[model samples]
Target: MDLLMKSLKIGVNEKLYIKDPESSTLGKNIVEQSILMIDEMGFDNFTFKKLGVKINSNESSIYRYFENKHKLLLYLATWYWGWVEYRMVFATNGISDPVKKLEKAVEILTQNVEEDSSISHVNEVVLNRLVINEYSKSYLVKEVNQENKDGYFVVYKRLVNRLSEMIAAVDGKYPYPISLASNVMEGALHQYFLKENFPTLTNCNDSITPTEFFTNLIFRTLNQNIHG
Candidate 1:
């Protein structure tokens, strides 16, 4: 019955970590506390030593899981993308309209995350904030090309592909489904950054949201191409 009752799981790329962070208590602490610390202090100041103290584990123990904080950040970002894709699927499932599914997918990507108790160790809210603020920095490094070769980005690409298919289903001839999907993902995060720092720069009012903003943009762009 336990096998029948198994919970949903999100998997990050194994190549990004020396050990899976979900396998034990100490490993789970490294993930859960790292998310809290990185969210509290920016990534530059976050270290395995500091995380060790916070989690009451040796620095070496944390190192057993990740090579460095950069890899940890990559791991977190990958996990978050998988989580977002999970939420997107749940939000859009059983909805027959492809366009409506795409709209829900946009909202899932853009809206603020709330804590989910099912995955008790990982806090989706802080993880979401971290992704919005720090996700791009995870890949904007000199080693990004090398990391890409290692499949560090598969989960992110999976989300893009999943979303792009929705676009293709809505309008098979839509010339830029991949580009638009990528834009919608990054633009949603960018809007949160803008809204948090420079609210005046965006029209993301309480009534009109970043999700609405991008949803309209995607539909209009695709529809225009369809009619032309």
Candidate 2:
């Protein structure tokens, strides 16, 4: 499901009614605009007043949708993960073969990185910082818990599990491990993105698109590790 559809389902399950289409759109707009602002200003420097001006909506209107700036950030993060999940689902749909499915998953994720550079950059900077801050300080722990319960992690866990199943399908004796695959996938992409785009980092002319690099790397690594 797309982020909006997922959000609507959650709202319905929670007995909340959108009631007003304009209000619903406005709230979503606020969250999206807030993320963009957080991207440009960094989370620490972003403020409700600044977001208000950017969205052309008053602070009171924003507060009506979100209790506070922290809540807004949480919602934005949730929406982001929702969008990622949506893309993954779309990319994996109609693929039945395990190996093909796994390849497609890698392709989708890598292509997503290049397809939406702005959102990808925002996710790298703002959402990652928030996750790290929460992990380090243990603040917002409860909010993170709530977000997970709302199916954000559920979708990712399912994806990983499916990938693991595919690996097992390919090689009967293979040690199918979702966590290991996930770590490898994320680590490779993080290195690529940081080196290519992050300021103050050494630039490497890797020149390879994420899809090409990941497709070859993942297939080769899996084949060597599991089949060799």
Listed in order, each prediction's TM-score against the native is 0.93, 0.66
**Model 1: how far residue 193 lies from native, Å:** 0.5
TM-score of 2: 0.66
Candidate 2 structure quality by residue, lDDT tens digits, 62-127: 766655665555544444444555666677788888788877776655543422334322333454
Residue 83 lDDT in candidate 2: 52
Which residue pairs show backbone clashes in model 2?
A: none
Model 1 per-residue lDDT tens digits across residues 99-175: 88888888888777765544767887789999988999899999999999999999898888888999998999998
Among these predictions, the greatest lDDT belongs to 1
Strongest candidate by TM-score: 1
Query: Which residue ranges in model 1 land beyond 4 Å of their true spot?
Result: 1-6
Candidate 1, residue 53: the lDDT equals 92
C-alpha root-mean-square deviation, candidate 1? 2.6
Model 1: lDDT to the true structure? 0.86
